[model samples]
Target: MAKKNKIGEYLYCITTKKDAPKEFNIKGMEDSDIRVMFYRDLAAIVSKAPLKEYEPTEENVEKHKTVALHILKDHTVLPVALGMVFKKMGILTSTMGRVYFVLKKSLNLIDNKIELGVKVILPKNFEESNNGKSIEELREECKTEFAKKLDGIAVESKEGKLFSDRLALNMSFLVDRNNIDKFSDILGKLDDKYNDLKVQYTGPWPPYNFVDVRIMSRGK
Candidate 1:
């Protein structure tokens, strides 16, 4: 007979008891049944898995993210880092106990908020459109004018890396759930006014940029 793999709880994300649903209809890592575990007011969404390190393969990463996004449909979540598996349920409960206050504070600050992304690209015919404006000049305009307009509508904003010279502004905004449409409206106007610049907007995704949550075993 084959030896059975040791069962462990794989954590997806954290939510308040009020926000966490009584049951989840989704599957998690290893196609295991998903369930909730609580420590006081905080609820941890978890699923069964073998007691081992799960590699960050494309499929596994998607499974992890999908669960969190599913929760976001009805709750404000504090997304725990990827690949957090507790060998014992007691350890999971204790870990939550240790970080109770921090979790509560974070949830309070980010409640009912979502993240959005924007990338402003320079037009190919830069010299023809603007007579002879330099890339530096265009970047400055993006920073002062375009950035400020979007920042006004967001609770918090983060600057992302630019992979190419054409990519002038790469930003992530933390916007209220209700103000998503308003944010889109402002971005649309900016896009129209700056016809020479190409704007790419995305999300209402989990606030990955704003929150840094990682709860490990053994209280580390």
Candidate 2:
């Protein structure tokens, strides 16, 4: 909550550059400006929101992601945790200054890297090729094929939880920005090969799963 003297900044993430997209603007909880606060070559993408007592409501969560997505379109961003606020701007500045090099190193680690998601769902009673194999058998084959395709292309990959009984595959891949089109092409081929199942693909999102940087200020 904002008192007469205490208002805080909601940090969305840290970007490699200061030239964030002015075209894509997002309003904070108090309908304030979401802009970059700089520290040398680093920039903290933030907006105004109440601190300590802040709740991660659906609206607030979406606002955080919206800002990150926009800035991520052209920059390498290290996403800060949600609901982070600094009572005094000095604390944030000093924190960023203290860890400036660490932040920059993280930015460089994720440079030109983006995350891609894939989910595959199969029918509970699904059958395999004309050979009459089981669903599990076919799913494993599909997994291997996809991995082989991305072996040298994608930088790294991690498996995710299979949310439902019918969900055969849920995973994320760290793909180079330059190879997105190539990644898409590989996905297309896999999709064609497994036409009977449901495959959902998403992102080019700021490697949220890959880069792990969180700003913990003592102000709260």
Per-model TM values vs. the true structure: 0.86, 0.86
The per-model lDDT (C-alpha) reads 0.85, 0.77
lDDT of 2 by residue, 27-144 (tens): 7656778867777877787776666555778877777777888877777768776778887678888989988988888887888788899888886666565567576787687678
> Where does candidate 1 stray beyond 4 Å?
1-6, 122-131, 164-166
User: What does the lDDT read for residue 188 in candidate 2?
Assistant: 88
- What does candidate 1's lDDT look like per residue over 1-220, in tens digits? 9878788889998898888888778789999888889889889999989877778899899999888888898679888788888888898998888889999999998899988999889876465335466777777777777668978889999998898878878889999998989899999998887777889998767888899888866732
Which parts of model 2 have CA positions greater than 4 angstroms off?
1-6, 22-24, 53-57, 124-131
lDDT of 1 at 36: 88
